[model samples]
Target: MKAAGFGYHRPETMAELLTLLADLPDARIIAGGQSLMPMMNFRVAMPQHLVDIEKIDGLDSINLRDGTLQIGAMVRQADALASPVIKKNCPVLADAIAYIGHQQTRNRGTVGGSLCHLDPASEIPLVCALLDAQLYIASRRGTRMMNFRDFADAPLTTSLAEDEILTRIDLPICDPDTRHGFGEYARRSGDFAVVAVATHLRFAGETITEARMAFAGLGAIQARADRLEMFATSQKLSPALIDKLAQEAAQMPAESDLHHDADYKRHLAACLLREVLERILRHG
Candidate 1:
């Protein structure tokens, strides 16, 4: 398939990009071009105008400041996976990205683009939601920030307005005492996860203090069961507690496709939760 012909505009400045976006209400912004290009090639998306922002100034910085990992919209996944700041502050994110496509794909994939694509099986949004990261969106009018929970509305959909562009993603620096781990079941190393789980655990001596869990490939969007996480914090990771967690996860609503049944997805969720929890307990 070939993409429909479209007008292309490259904006070297953020103001120019925003202005172009505001002017061309139906234009699609291309940053990394990894996600959008493929869809365009398939003719799934055929915007009349393309506002390329790869040359925009001040949009690809990866830095840690004031207890947050500030990643610009254009920061490539490969670079992010290699950042010392990310490795130390949010290793779980780095781990999750390892499962996204291959090095070539990650080399061209942008954090903002991936999150905005909002694929139910994508790793970036799941990590953002699990870690309670903040998203920064901008437009010619003004800028505003929101947490990932509000940023992601549904699969392949977000709260971003037509004229707005995601500018940056702020990931909270992990607590020194918090242990992070991520696990997923995929057909291949670089394939979308069949079912994935990201978890952060805090322990008071040998007892668990706090726990955070988020899932992918289980619902309309990546989700967290606050009740389940809070319940995990209710007791140590004993065999009984692990069984309880799995049972709770088995009840989470999950959609089914032609390849997998709803019951199968739910079973995978329990399996992933059990695997990740045991890993954290053994290593942390």
Candidate 2:
């Protein structure tokens, strides 16, 4: 169905967008609109005004500063996936984006849009949690940075005030010892994942120094598998240890949906986590 009556304004600059957002507190910020358009079509969101930021200049660049990679809010997913900086600094992010929708959707979807949209089954959130990415936000008051873990409140919900616009995402550069892997199970190539896992392992010589694991498509918010991570890090990086961690991760709380029951999702999570851990351990 066509979107209910709404007004649209395409801002040419960040300042202009901020002013418009301040004036129209309830207005929805549209960047790429890949996720928003579907919600609008389904009548899940009926904003009175849409502040389109696609034409706003300079919000589509990717830069490396100091030891962090900064990606502008409007950077397309396809561009991000092809970015050498992203590949070198945050390969897990590149891997996660590779699993997002199709080429067309990736061309039209923005990194900021995906993070702000906060779909529980999406890859962006899981990447954020795994990398401990930071989100930059701008409002009439000033700019503030939020940890990804705190920025996302629930599925499709964020802590962003209505007047705040996500400006960029800041990801730490991957250390030489850092090893990462991403895994997901979807019914089809372009479908949302039934269960997804992103794993980051830091190896010191041979023993596991650190392990960070995040999960999607199972909780209201993308979450870190803390118990699993702790267990995996405390043990040797072996197939048996990975299997035990996967079993523990599978026991974590999971939401049930019509497509899959909680028990089934738990099993999938365990299997995928083990697969991802094994791949990273073997390759790195």
Candidate 3:
């Protein structure tokens, strides 16, 4: 199938982009086109106007400022994977990005695109959920910041208004002593995850001071293991605790898809989470 004919507008500045967006209510913003183009080609998406924001400046940087990792919305996946700042400040994110599509896709895939696409199995949104990311949104009226949990509305949907652009992603940097781990299972390399788990632990000597656990591919959006995360705090890492957490993860609600059943997805989630948690303990 071919995409329906549409108007194309490439804005050189954010001001111009905002104006175009405000004027075209039915317009869709195109960044990397990794997701939108496919949908357009399939006729799954038929926007009357396509606004391209690639020419806009200051939307492709990766910086660490005021203890926050600020990644511009246009930062490409491959660039982010190779970024020293990402690797140093958020290693789990770097690890997860390696599992996104293949080299060719990652080469053009943008961070903001993935977040907006909000695939159930997308690694970027999963990491953002685990890290409690902040999203900066802008429009002609004003700008606002949203929590990742609130920004994500439903599958393939976000809370972004028609005229708002996601400007950047803000991730609070974890403590240097925080240990992080990520693991995922896919039928093949570069495929979307069947089940993926990410976690970070800030330890005071032997006891956990803080723990964040999040999983993807089990629901409409990535879910944080709140109960398990709460249980992990002030607890010592041990085989028993790991086993218990894995069991709890296996009981989390899962949705069946064409490729896998709910039970199988739960099983995979448990196994992946256990592996990630155990790896963190081993390396810590």
lDDT of each: 0.88, 0.90, 0.93
Clashing pairs in 2: none
The best-first sequence of candidates by TM-score reads 3, 2, 1
Per-residue alpha-carbon lDDT of candidate 2 for residues 1-284, written as tens digits (9 for 90 to 100): 77887999998988898999999856999898999998898889999999999888888999999899999989999999999989998999999999999999999999999999999999988999988999999988999999998899978999998889999999888899888899999999979999999988888886788889999988888989888888878567888898788779779899999889999999999889888888877876
Sliding window of 10 residues with minimal summed lDDT for model 3: 172-181
TM-scores, in order shown? 0.97, 0.97, 0.98
Candidate 3's C-alpha runs over 4 A off are none
lDDT of 2: 0.90
How would you encode candidate 3's per-residue C-alpha lDDT over 1-284 as one tens digit per residue?
A: 78999999999999999999999869999999999999999999999999999999999999999999999999999999999999989888999999999999999999999999999899999999999999999999999999999999998999999999999999977776699999999999998898899998998998889999999999999979898998899999888889999999889899999989999999998899889888888877
Report the CA-based lDDT of candidate 1 relative to the real structure: 0.88
For residues 74-151, what per-residue lDDT tens digits would candidate 1 score against the true structure? 989999899888888889989998888899999999888899899998899889989888999999989999999888
